[model samples]
Target: MDETAQEKKLSAHNASPTQASDHPADPVLSGGFRFDRMELAGAFGDLGTLLPIVIAMILINNLSPSSVFFAFGLLYLLSGFVYRLPIPVQPLKAVGAIAIAYPAVVTESVIGASGILFGAFLLVVSLTGLMDWMAKLFSQAVVRGIQLTLGLVFLKKGIELIIHKDLFMSGAQNRLAEYPVNLIIGITVFALVLLLLDNRRFPAALAALVVGIGSGLALGGFSTLTLAFGPTDVRLISPSMSDYWTALVMLIIPQIPLTIGNACVGTASTCTSLFAGNPLLAKAKAGMFALTMGIVNLPAGFFGAVPMCHGTGGLAAHYRFGARTGGAPIMIGAFFILIALVLGELGFSLLALIPRSVLGVLLVFAGLELCPLLRNLKTNEEYFVALLIAGIALAVPNMGWAFAIGIAVDFFIRKMNVRI
Candidate 1:
């Protein structure tokens, strides 16, 4: 996007003339909800990142959808009230992807174990001030590198969702539509989103969902729908050493860098830039975010909910789509709470109503939202490190390895006084 368009996308509300919100954080000033068309549209901004993973885990891992939904709702609520911005809550992408790809090794229990284990690590870093010390180790170039890698990853997944058409590796047995049909729906929604993306009167996300849901219903979304009220029975988690081992290798190591670098530090940076001058966003710090994510997951491990994070991509999605105040997360949170209460695990069937094509559109935009952040990189050396990190992560398809390489390279560059 050009500078003007990027500015519009980052503005508090696309239609509103102010960078500060209409309520300007409201009667409380530092924290409150502001309901409006923009906030409503922004509410579902990250569903692209959310629904697929949860549904797949529920189907593949046999975790309770009700508890997953409930956990998400509560987490979103916490993000809104505490952060006072439309920051987001999402499943750990690396962990979710690992479980989905290798269900045999990374079972539901393994995922739950990851939640507990990683949550504990986050607490240690956050509470004991280790996060501050660790934060110093990650240079801006490395952080941007991490964010760039994720943006590219989202873009890839978005494309796959479009082409595969069967809920990320669901295969021929579960493929929903033929290639042509999938293409048409995805293209139509994508075009519509681009055209109406900045329009306040008819918000882009809301419009895209309307088409998605309508298309899904037309394709027989109701035939499989059944009411199954939930927050289903919670089971006490008792993961074995093997489970913890798998969780650490496949989920924790691969994913923890993201929660710390992007979710915590990178998101704090995004908040400072996007919500500058807003008092409500003043406390949006890396340590606090680290703590909040641990809080999001500790209770989750007991019920086998997916591990959660405050991904910067989700925040970019909300802001790009017009979320301004706390209302956005609250709106999405309440919606999920209702889904858990009313539809329970069966809500997955209903969500299937919205086609993968539509969801792909969401993923594409959310990924693209991160592009602007990269423009902040100034020096050639910073750009080189960031690009190298992104290339290694995407090429290896392993963030854990990429992060280690990034740190070593950044340190070498600083020590050698190397000039790119």
Candidate 2:
């Protein structure tokens, strides 16, 4: 080779390492901690996305801190090990918060990572190309039905927050203010979100969540700054094998749909709509991850833990933060592990700093994400099936049966050839 050509080759070889160093191949396991643009965006944007979810799990699920820790530990382990997705995983804190709000009202012990496990399974199935076949099993009507049902359910939940301002009290505070605060926060954030969503001028979701949360804090809305933060002395919970069985039954039956139907599907659709330029993967991924979550929950339930799942709230945050791959989840998982170890009264205290009203705002905005499904009602059979699913889901209070009803409806529709 000529000297000029050899020099060019040498320069190219030397430059490769620098180019490689500019970005890690994967965000989850990379050791150097060089923040990816998506990671930073997701980190900041997801905070609000995560807030209402975490709050809901705590209030609705009625889980203890120990249970929370165990769930996170399991989530961390599975996200890194079993699913093998490029995504980072964390305990669904929103699951915990939602559990707390509903308080075994819908599913028992909502603090665990069961939903997330399910989502992971669904994701795997999608990746493996099983989703299309699965999708064929149900009609577009059934799928849209499920989406509409979940949207309505979440909408009710948002309204319930508004309705129950008198109930969520702390110390001497009425917390009634939380209702209006939530309304204001939610409206403001949502409006901003819609605008930024169109332009991408800023990290819209994260900004909305931050503005809402920060406004709450600045206005004496909530404050965790005084709370403790360090290594927490967490006690691992050990429940009997029976408790596991009970938890398994509770999670596997009633709440499975929440994972498969709502969370997994919702997330996949959002991603497809936003990033990958296709919604087919969303359908497949949701089911794949749902199955994975089932496997994770089966064993973890025996350890006195609650189940976990992704929330639209968190996914919205993930999307807002610009998370392209699974790396956002991986980062979230690390956060869970750290909180499990270091959060105690301090952590709870920090959580306390978030006004219940502010959290309500988060939930309200989250519910709005489901609004796109309102278009489903424009169709006849779809509207009928969707309302039926929503009614069943809202009434039965068991997620399993609710999903079963929807799927069962699918069978009936197919048998009749009604074209629903």
Candidate 3:
């Protein structure tokens, strides 16, 4: 071809079609689907991290799995449709998986949305650009105090899962001998989880979940079939609205801040730290995030479920694996919903089979993995922060002023001219 013709062809190839077109289906930039090994891993890895948490939450908290399912479903939908920045939503999952049960144990009913409320608190701060402003009023000591508290919250719960495996079981201590089947199932699931983690072929938690489901089916776990789509006298019994109101009221004081504060200081921070090396992306959408979860959770609650949240720990795991964006949450959330709905009894029964010892071992490994974070705290300020946070987490139940205590500690440290 002639030089002029060749130059014209090169120019055509170089120019974006949208730049040249009068109208385009979408801007050319929209066509590319970004993927990274760590982000993708983080997204997909959440399933494994979330499963055990789900099991523990369900059994210990006596919260409905439906709530978790709906919450997550909404979270993912909102992450994509609203936030538009596909940050992983696993922090809430990790937190909920561990903490939801405790609140349920206290309240005697499942609760939802408190975590979202907490997130809303932070979301408002972030959206209004107040985190930067608040950053000044508190010294590093105060922030570290909050960080330490968050870490210990996770660590303490991790220890509890391992140490008190039978605390949430159905029968009394004397009837333990009758639950050989449950022990076997639980132990097996725990072992399977470790095996999967070692191999990294499939997710450890998801593998455990599958094994639990299979075992449940084998053991005739679904024998007591009750729930379905149809509205009948048999299946349509409503949860006492008064009881629900009481539960919500009971949860309000604790959950709203717990969920929202944790999201800002814990989940957002974790994801930000984990994805530090990644390319710049837009800030996540807020209203859509809330709307997405609200859409699913409102329905799921009526059917007996706990509210779910995206967990940071779970998100970190996904990043370690290879999930790129919101796509991973969609997959995990959908899978969870399917299990809770179509295979409810089977899934629960399977989870019930895990052995306490094995479960303990799994949680212990997870907790130990966090030791390096402690090592990174080289300053006295960090030490103070970590201990203070852990202490409040330990004391919050016994002391009515956990938040006040944390703040007081921070104030005292700041007044003393501590440098962290």
Candidate 4:
């Protein structure tokens, strides 16, 4: 929506609180859209979270790279055109993680089928306004808890990559295996990003990628890459009853709460906070977020693509690195489409050139950007719930369980009329 139209909608509502104090003041919306160096640079913000899972799924599960990249490209374009904001679109993290870790169980048919059923479920919930009521159950503290939980999850994943703890998940073989090149490269890029994080003249993400790519080429990354041309293969899948059952039990059950808490609620709240000055932007609802995820995943599921959703961390990464408008995602969308065309099934191996450590740094920084969200949790009771959620999520290694425990405690406190 344009500024004038958004301004009108906000005024017609007949309400505007003193100021939306939900999250920290991130004034990106004030600039509208731009297609400059910074937007180009910021376009790569979420690749850290995006690339590894994509690579793993394609390499491990024999997924159609063309379909996956095409789905991502289309989804990115849809979000750009519809919301006209740099709203993040990411693979369903838990689903992708589980599939990568256990490719034997999460076969291509199972992954595709999971998308079909899960998308339908979210569509029902979103269209019926069920998520709206469910969202009200989430307090600011709970949202913060979700944010912290996902951030920590991203942090832990990045650390694991840097140290090469379980390297097979990403299909990334340590190219410079003799020594800890990933660790060294990770530290170098991490430092470079920190030094230039706020420098508009030289965006952090852009600088980091340049360094990482250079390091990768120096370490014999180019030898592994193969170039292909022409259209990428894409076809629909016919999932069996067993595929659906596996998807339901292993993928959907564990992923639902994270999708609800982080993807819908966490993302919408982060959008409102970052774009707080605009009531239209603030009006970006959890239902709308869910609807988009459902809409995209419907096709993504049919075509053997990994399920996708929004994330607070991706938004923070984009905005912090200087993506002011939908242009950032458009740039990325087009990039992916081009890659799918040129690289075809070889789309993933090209990225294997960059050190895993560099990818880890991107994830770490994205998580750090989410720290600003926790600043608004003022009271001790709020802190208790949020921190407890964070602790449980990391310890249990499950966002679904953490969200359940957090909301239960939130309701209990409210009913008791007591502070922690």
Candidate 5:
């Protein structure tokens, strides 16, 4: 066989159970996992989602970086093993954003209780199969709309990060006043990423990280490397009655809708779209998605670790940068574990070395990857529904609301027998 024929054979053989057989499996399945430099780079492709929230929680909420890193690392490894794909574990953005924005109002106990309560809720939903029902409620139009909105959000954030001086040091500077040197560096990195995107032998994300590190070092971003071996003081925490109450009313209530819309429905749709030929891919049902979040956050909550979830954006980011197997998460997970162990207290200082521009470029491309999914909408009616949902999602900046709106619009259109 020629190289192309051989590649086709490998792909067909690796198709998930759903694609391979008429009947799909009940539980989530995985494709074969491979560990390589490409997978390693794919692991870090979603840093834009992980780092910002983590940094904020640590700085604003006084959360322990060691505990957060450890939880994230351990969970990522487990997710890869369980899903057998590049399923990403990411910080719960709604909770993280709320906590960061209102640190004075949101207490640590509240955060911990939120995670515990949310985890339990998800666990029950998954076990009872309620998540499967919920997943079915979202139409393809709604899912596509959510994906587009998320892609745009990431893209906008990426552009912001790229133009800024540095995430930590920059205050309010001119939008166009970035140092000429930094602009040059950003342009160079962006160009390199675009050029190497299709080059399997040289993963673009890996190349970007290498260039970013080199540039950061040369620019004195890491003038001193402080490696510490001090023991971390993370312990299991039990939430109080008040903490649970606070979490239920404040955090859990707002987060549930978002989680159901994005983490469950959005992620499952993305997986199926990407791996259509694999029957096992269909096993990435809403219940399984919920189970992963519940398993990760329940224990992590006790230790004040940042709660995590599987996100469509993170999945797209990983797959966009050449991550095709379970090995990608495992590789990245091990790196996080190493960071947690070696730099228990000094984690923030080390992360500070990464340049904002490089991360921006990565986010930009990851967002770009998601845009192609919009093409899946075949009808003008589908496009109209999708555009409506996308508009609502972007305008209100609430994915849950947008999801509901999209579904309602789609239903109404179908009911009216509207033809475009």
Candidate 6:
């Protein structure tokens, strides 16, 4: 079939009522709110993406856990209500990676400023409808390429997490070599995930978490567990002019292309793919996405919240498990709020006890969930462009550069009528 015909067929399939109502439960009739086992399991589907950054910011940058949790919880709660879907609020990966890798160079103030500046930028673009305009510029091939690249990225990270021991754990002894305990755990969880992928009665993520926590406790990973309740100290962060400038140049500038490509365009595309028949869930435009970022980050920046975004990966992770409505984020948000208000520092300790192998299994499956989009490529040229973008993205370790190069190559090929 021709590209146009293929596109039409896919659209038709997505718009079918059967596809829309394929979830284990009808979200619309359920009042779009569910706190069942599947929803709770879906809540942790993106923990592999969330916890590392939160822990890094707290441990390395000395950011207050309570404040961060509060911001995270608050945003998750707001996003669920506003989007009325399983749409997630995730830490911006670009900013998190840079901040975590170079803690000395990227201070808390710098991170805070990056959030504020980026928030303002998104707000302006969203208000001006520039986001919508930009979103239209990318072809389906480009979007698919971005998804493929991200899937591979997640796969790489998941493997790393599985093979390596926890950073907090002592003894440089390799977990894979010592007794292959982590490897065994990873395989077991992976098999379990596969087995339960389609079983609504059994939530794979929740089961994985249970196994992970159980294994951690057996290994004496959590020596002590304490719960403390107190007023979280949330202080206003006022970045100086220099700090703002530095963040704009160093952090925000580098992140803009990624924000545009993955957070906005890719996310919107994935929503359409996943919820093809459900107009309300599928029609996430770039402007709406940017607005969410602006709304969440504005407060997050001022209060030292981890800068956040709604990315395609997070959405896929949530859907891969069992989340079918806004209830997932609401449930997770409430959990975070409780942690922030009651557990505070102790929350980190509990998170630390979750075996890295289990988290790795989750990441692996999340990555796998995103791989289906690649099957949409119709032509050899399209496949070439997508593969090129994925290769470049992995090699350069930058999605923005990959996107730019892919677009240029695609344009050149089309203009020249080059049949590769």
lDDT by candidate, in order shown: 0.78, 0.47, 0.45, 0.77, 0.76, 0.78
Instruction: Write one digit per residue (lDDT tens) for candidate 6, span 1-420.
Output: 013444445545533242235543566334467677777888889987787677777778767777788878888898788776778778888888888888897888888898899899999999999998888766788888988988888888888878764422322233344476777788888999899876678889988988887877676665544455553567788999988988887788788888888888888887777665454644477788899889878868887778888888888898788776788999998888888888875675677677677878888888887877788787889899989999999999567899999888988888899897
> Deviation in angstroms for 117 in model 2?
12
lDDT of 1 by residue, 185-285 (tens): 88889999999888889999999889987776666566666666665555667899998888888789888777777788878767765765567656788
lDDT of 2 by residue, 1-420 (tens): 011333233323322222222444532223223245444445444343344454445444544544455465556445434332223233443244434544544343222334434444555665676654554444444555555555565556655653444322232243454545545655665567666653434755456545644654565534334355654443344444453454345444445445555556544443333323222233225555555555665555444345555444455444433544444455656665566567654555454454444344444544554445335334576666767776776786565465667777767775797764
lDDT of 3 by residue, 1-420 (tens): 011333234323323223222223322124223333333333444443445566656656556655555455556655544332344444344235335545633332334334433444445655566654543333333334444554455456545544553523332232343455555555565566556553434656445545544554454434433445322221222545555555455554544444433433344444334333223222422222333444554554444444554434444444334443455555555655565566565544544544343444333344433333343344686577656655776675521244446556667776897676
Model 5: residue 118 alpha-carbon error in angstroms: 1.3
lDDT of 2: 0.47
Candidate 2 Cα deviation (angstroms), residue 359: 3.4
Expressed as tens digits, the lDDT of each residue in 160-191 for candidate 4 is: 77787332333345555677777777888888
- Please identify which of the two predictions, 1 or 3, would achieve the higher TM-score against the true structure: 1
Ranking by lDDT: 1, 6, 4, 5, 2, 3
Candidate 5 error regions (>4 Å): 1-30, 167-182, 223-225
* Model 3: ten consecutive residues of lowest lDDT: 228-237
- C-alpha TM-scores of all predictions: 0.90, 0.64, 0.61, 0.89, 0.87, 0.90
Task: Report the error of model 4 at residue 233, Å.
Answer: 2.9
What local lDDT score does residue 323 receive in model 4, on the 0 to 100 scale?
Answer: 71
CA-RMSD of model 6: 3.4
- The CA lDDT at 102 in model 1 is 93
Displacement of residue 413 (Cα, Å) in model 6 is: 2.7
What tens digits encode model 5's per-residue C-alpha lDDT throughout 1-420? Answer: 011333234344433333323333312223567777667778989987788778778777887777888888988898888777788888887788788888886777778888888899999999999998887777877787888888888898888878776533212132334455455667889999999886768988889878876776566655444466653667667788988897788678778877887888888877776655554565577789899889988878888888888989998898878776678888888878877777675555556555677878888887887766777676899899888877887788446787787888889888999998
TM-score of 6: 0.90
